[model samples]
Target: MTAQAARHHAEGRLAEAVTAYTDALRLDRRNPALLSGFGLVLRDLGQIDGAATCFEAAFALDPGCVDAADSLGTLRAGQGRFAEAEACHRAALVHCADRAPFWNNLANALSRQGRAAAALAAWRRAVLLDPALPEALSNLGGGLCDAERLDEAERTHRRALRLMPDEPQANNNFGHALQARLRHAEAARWFRRALALDPGYAAALCNLGLAVQRLGDGTLAERLYGRALRATPDLPLARFNRGLLRLERGDLAEGWAGYGWRFASGQAGGTRPPRLPAWRGEDLAGKRLLVWGEQGVGDTILFSSLCGEAIARARSVVIETDRRLVPLFARSFPAALVRPHGPGAAAVPDCDLHTPIGSLARVFRRDLSAFPGPAGGWLVPDPARVALWRERVATLGPGLRVGIGWRSALVTESRRAAYSRLDQWGALFAVPGVVFVTLQHGACEAERVAAEDLFGVAIHRWDDLDLTDDFDGTAALMANLDLVIAPATAVGELAAALGVPVWRFGGRDWTQLGTAVRPWFPAQRLFQPQGGEDTPGVLRRMAGQLDSRLI
Candidate 1:
């Protein structure tokens, strides 16, 4: 090749190099060297089929042309023809048995085909052959990350970064490992650096958004998601996050449709069993609909109320719910069939239509004005369970049967927004003539310990309440309570559904559309932070409300 063609190829000016290589090949049509050079240039230009043709022509003339074989293999790998790529790589290995790049390319093909063990071994061989192969190191780290060996993945990422400190993939991989460790701030910093190194780094941008969202700065998170979408509109997770923000804002039209990407984008997994088809917009007239639970117990209870509404749109309704609440829901929605959720949970195939219990609101939800008021009393406390609870509460003395919950699930890392400190709960604890009963589980171990340590008064304990921490327990407890005070979770929803009086503490920026007074739950009262999430003020208000309600 001419010096000009070589310079163009070296500078990554693939189109110019392709033109020059084509000109040289046309003059020496039968020259295997010229044909091989032309193929490499075509491959660099992303003209993979053309590159394969040129590589075939070169290999036909010189059967042992390992470069031509390797190029063809790499092209086939990019096209997802893993078997063909493996054949070409093996052929190239016969001629050049120690080529690390060829081995790395073979590993890439193997990893794509779900042969991760073989991929790791091949990658180890490539790294052994060429210790400076940063690409091989990075790919190996990703494979380890997929296998959940996060410590090994972290070490491998650091190794790749040492070779190339600004490598976007290495930085992104390191961020992922940090995120798995719950080091959101550190993860966000790494992802930001990756984005700075490659401004169009879509994966880095998405990770940064997720990290910030975990940190409870939805404003910054939304901006990062927008930036990612600007860089790549088709990035599904970015679209999904944007949709979540919109949904949170109550912009249902665009939000619900964008929300559909979770299942379609391969994010929400366990791939909804194929035996049950998704409820596409089809005819539901006179058909039985089986609405089943898919997420947490609280989410199940909060959304299950919509099942009766869904039944209004179908011929018959059947519900599959968490086993803890199956008896309760069966008793409540007797018009519809109800079953406890379990392995091989039978779906009423007799139902022509089906939707997740959560999706009922998506299909039939109405405007705020139309949010059906508390319908059936699905959450009645079992007479037996309530009697046991009464006996338990009676032991604490009947100042007032005040149930308390101060923690949410561990689904997100934003703890400060979800739960005020134990001292915040002191507002009600100090209130005269009230017994503080613990209903929350998990994370509160510290709070519980501190409360007992700080104050000699041991608050009433019912840790064995068998309450599933879902709204059902809340429902049963609310029915027996003088008043309920809890964080913004499914319990709050349960209290609302039961039309039982509750004091709800919420984040500062909760949707203004749903004011502190919720119409859906007539007895529900919301208490938000006055200045900057004043937990004391929320408790003080709850104490005052309880004093007024009882006296």
Candidate 2:
């Protein structure tokens, strides 16, 4: 009977195996091996409760049943009960301490529980027990990468590849390590290798699409995303990437629809409020609406423009935003109550419907024509602060006062390559009657000194204001400037929102939909490097434009 049950299980007939195993268990109810085999069959048949009972009985009958303990641990881990899984794995390891599979499973559970150091130790033990375990080596490589030991991770991944050259997971993980190091071209090759091993691998396809996108092939990346979605229809990462690609191409309708998947994809921060229903373009004649901010400060400022439209429909509105922007948002939207996000803000005020600030685009700005004009500036800076800044600016001797921001707060390699270098501002500095004031926040003393020494010009700095933490003060300072010349940072966004003239420098094909200007901010001018020209060339062109304007 046991042989027949084993045959059924081996043949992949889970239901037949369960029936035969039950008959065999009835004959020898107290046999630990029989009970463990029955538990395995039950687990395969999807009877989780029955399988757990059989495993527990088998363990009670004979605590030495290592297979029963290992199986139970795997089941618990799959069910997200990592602590119970760890206990089961530890029991199995007590009997077979040298077992590679037992140590590997223990490592997986520990890693899922966010115990990275312990997980690394367990993984190392597994590899030491069996040096040929490719999966363990791959996981150890991933752990090393997470610890920022990039060189060791690369070597470990190479070892795994040598052992199992055609392993899809190892290939994909190796590609990820390479991608983290910004070797996109090499990463794409490994991703392709993974796809070759298993063509239906949705994760590899999505990763390859990102690699190609970074390599400046948006069209191909879009096609890969489409393939990934077709293979795995509910993949959030693929959907989110598709949405970004569509938006970049100016397909607003499809773009906004895909953009709504950001929260589900975990690309956007914060979970949706549990009790409040999401707003879906319904008429809110007498209901209170909550509009909460998501993403960065620049994104919040950009999306705040839609509040006026929301105000026109809802009877009352409440805005929850970053702490720094509370004063500015409250004064700008006096009709609505404004609060900073924190502990008490989690329990939202009485509201009929709630929506993320970015989600408002789907309801209001469905197309390019739906955007408001240059007169649509909704942010109102404090008049007193504006007056104070105006008086301070009067002491700088009457030239064209320009606020310059050349760096972003979150500096990445891609941003560094895209933004204008401090030395590149030589041409702009040489422009007569143009006085440059530093609007950039953070540790700029080194860069400022270098720029001044290199360009032989003084870039004025104000020591009294905390530009990064004080949005209202920043807005007031922006209000007093004649023009702002900056990269596509938050400063540019703030200046454009305040109706100040801004020249935003960017990389090739960065301006959305190939347009020379962004429809969201009509007061801002978009400048891209022309004819293989670098940052210096772009700055020279901007200087020439300023010269013509001054003349």
Candidate 3:
């Protein structure tokens, strides 16, 4: 009967195998191998609790039972108990050190626990044990992509596809490697192939949507995202992608809800958010609120617009922000205690409630009506420093002081298409009676030199003011500028927040929230690309405006 049950299990007859195993187990209840065999059949039949019980019984009878340990570990992983899964896999490996699949399973559990480097090492060990292992190769490819070793990932994924030709997950993972390399069209083809293999594959659907979105079909992208969510309603990547699309398309109510999935999608960075009692727009009449900054420096500034509103409701407010912005925030919100924040900022004591700065938007800026603010700006610069900067700029001769930033310092391949060369802005640089000054915060000396050498036009910047570290000084300097022209970078955000007339170009970000004008900044003059218009082309149009209006 045991032999017949093993044969049935091997032949994929799970129902018959279960019945045979039951009969065999009645005679030999303490047999570890029989119990493990029954567990495998129960697992195949989707009776997870029954399988776990059988496996636990088998392992208890014989701790060296490899099959029982491995099966239980896999089941734990399926249940999202990754740490316990890791321990089980480790125990199996101790007795069966040569098993490649055991290493692969262990790698998966490590990866889920956010130990990327350790997972990659484990996957490498699995591949070393059995080079033909398709799953390990596929997972290794993903790890390489995460580490930004694109060339290695591309090669690894191609090999994985060769081994797993009809596997949807392998194909989808390969497409991710291609997508990371900026090969969107090719990635879309692989994603389509994955969908062909498994039409209801939610991951492939979401990946295809992203690839098509990059190809400039927002409508198709949105439809694909919807389809993916319909297949798996809790798909994080789909929800996050759909949220960005909805925000850009002007659908706020659903957009913010979807955007909240960013933390799960790994787009917002960090493995864990600050551990504290989350503030959900509660009445804080006598409560202290601790709001920590997330995202970039510019984002902190943009969201700081709501600090005053938060302070009005709370008895006391604690604004934890980038160290550079500490002085500026302290001066602006004198009523609040502003502190310099780093990692593990949630340990602040005496706070009644906590919230990430970005979450403030869902409550305050639920509609377009919440965007408009004060005349001067939400952030107030030091009066003495502003007057000093005004005097310094007055020495440069009589003309409008215009601050310009051509591009972001941290431009990756995905962002390269949106940015233009600094020389492409010669038309704006040539605008008569405007003193072009560099508002770029980092590594602009090289670009400024090259631009001056190429066009005989200099974009002047003061040496004393460290734009990167001295936010107070940068704020004061920006307050003196007549207008600021830049891409959608931190410079543009700062200038706009300071209430200077800022022309922000090359923007297709979700932060626009579907407004022609920046509802966040009353002084912003948008120069976003019109249909088929590149940023350089948009800058040329701004040049024309510069001559016609400002000049």
Scored by TM-score, the top model is: 3
lDDT of 3 by residue, 392-483 (tens): 88888867788888777777656676567887988887888888888887887888899989878867888999988898998899998899
Q: TM-score for all predictions?
A: 0.66, 0.83, 0.85
Report the lDDT tens digits of candidate 2 across residue range 99-149. 998998999899877788999999999999999999999999988877667
Model 3: how large is the Cα RMSD against the reference? 3.7
In model 3, the clashing pairs are none
Candidate 3, residue 196: how far the Cα is off, in Å: 1.6
TM-score of 3: 0.85
TM-score, candidate 2, is: 0.83
Candidate topping lDDT: 3
- Show where candidate 2 strays beyond 4 Å: 1-11, 20-156, 180-182, 215-217, 270-274, 508-514
Clashing pairs in 2: none
**Least accurate 10 contiguous residues by lDDT in model 2:** 508-517
Angstrom error of the Cα, residue 529, model 1: value is 3.2
Candidate 1 lDDT tens digits, 1-551: 65677789989988788788878877889887778888888777778788899898888888788889888888888776998898888788888879898889888888866688998988888889998899988887877776666788788878988998988878887888778767899999899889889989987898899899878887898899889888988788888776666666666656666566665444553324425666854667887777777656666766666676666667887777767677778767777888875556663356665676655555665345556564434455566766766666677776777777776755343344567667666656766777776666565667777886775546666555544544355455567777777887666666655656677787633232234454345456678776664677777787777777667
Ranking by lDDT: 3, 2, 1
Report residue 2 deviation for candidate 2 (angstroms): 8.2
- Angstrom error of the Cα, residue 35, model 3: value is 6.9
